[model samples]
Target: MNAIAAPAAADDNGLETGLNATLREPISADGTPVLGKTYTVPARHGRAVRVKAGQTIRIANPHGTQVCDTWIFNAEHLNEFLSFEHTRAYIDRIIPQPGDPLVTNHRRPIAELVADTSPGVHDTLMAACDLYRYRNLGVEGYHDNCADNLRLALKAIGLRTREVPQPFNLWMNIPVKPDYSVEWLPPVSKAGDYVDIKAAIDCVVVMSACPQDIIPINALNPLDVEFTVLDPAVSSHS
Candidate 1:
């Protein structure tokens, strides 16, 4: 592994790596923030960050309660999108673990999970919050949702709503009960909990600071989250 260009990745520590039960944190060192900037996504808004090949983006729940609905795309190819179905097909488990690649529709790996500190509670089965969903749920009026936020954020890059693919809910806790039905649950991620993904190829990452207040997904409230893009090329090995 190119330690100078790529931090410890999933290939270095396999998915079976366990987290300390008392306190979970980032997989590898936070490293030096060199290549990109850190963006604070305020509540009810979305943001996009682009990174080159081999860079790592760390999405963190600073408050430990907010969920970030995230989507990925190949910067050069619009047709290829993030496909949870294919990702599930590649792994034996539904929830991502360290070393799992977030694959594109063609099964191309764009990002791989290098480390996570939230007790492995993420949801790949649910769709982003949308107005239609709110309306169906008997919401009184228009409400903020992750879907629209994602579209608004992607617009800056010339992608339309149709191209905004399904998201990977980071730090979300949606569990399936024994009845085979799913239920929204509060996240277990504490403050400073984060998940790091090493970009295998150049890709655009879109995230909604999840405005899901109607459910317990965000603990019935929405808050801000933090995004950090780490350039391993300038980082020193420990």
Candidate 2:
């Protein structure tokens, strides 16, 4: 029989690695939002909202410089989430275009990129920033980070994910160089630019206005972003 190595001592519980305001506020008790109302994800904070199948979520870059770290999870099964690796393979591109299907770890379409008002420049390669990342940057005390924001956001809405998957970094530019290196650059999107993601299945969408002041990303000034859930029926009925 083969021997299995025991895991190292660590905080493995699916809870917030640390705390922040993201734990206090949820768009709603269960992460539900008004059908057509816009909600703000404050700078250095995160928010989660539920999107039903056939509904679309429009995330706006009011400042254009703010980077939004995004994630989508199947409402029924947290383990099934939008997987960038699978999505990149599914779409045959690292950056998904407006028409591309956002695929999940199960190799199924969980959401579709319905519209993109800005230049198609988003990142799928970088892990969401964490407390350790801040520590490495010489930040003392607690720092608000996307990884913890994700955890606390979900926890705020009575949900938890065992793993923190790589997020779809919306409006986050990391251009690849000729030598295969990448540069973290500011977003090219302009104010009012937005992307609309339509749910292929019932899912929860989370957004973190990345708090990375140490880097050029977010233009070194993290700011708030907004989102709204658009119900197709409303437009159709009106």
Give me the candidate number with maximum lDDT: 2
lDDT of 2 by residue, 132-164 (tens): 788889977677889888988999999998889
- Give per-residue CA lDDT, model 1, range 1-238, as digits (tens): 1011111244321111111110111212221233656667777777766767888888889999999998887777756768898899877689889989889899878889888877989999988877667778887555666766665565544444344466899988888989999888889899989888888887777778888788788898899998888757654212
lDDT of 1 at 61: 93
- Name the best candidate (by TM-score): 2
Model 1 compared with the native: what TM-score?
Answer: 0.81
Residue 82 in model 1: lDDT: 80
lDDT of candidate 2 vs native? Answer: 0.89
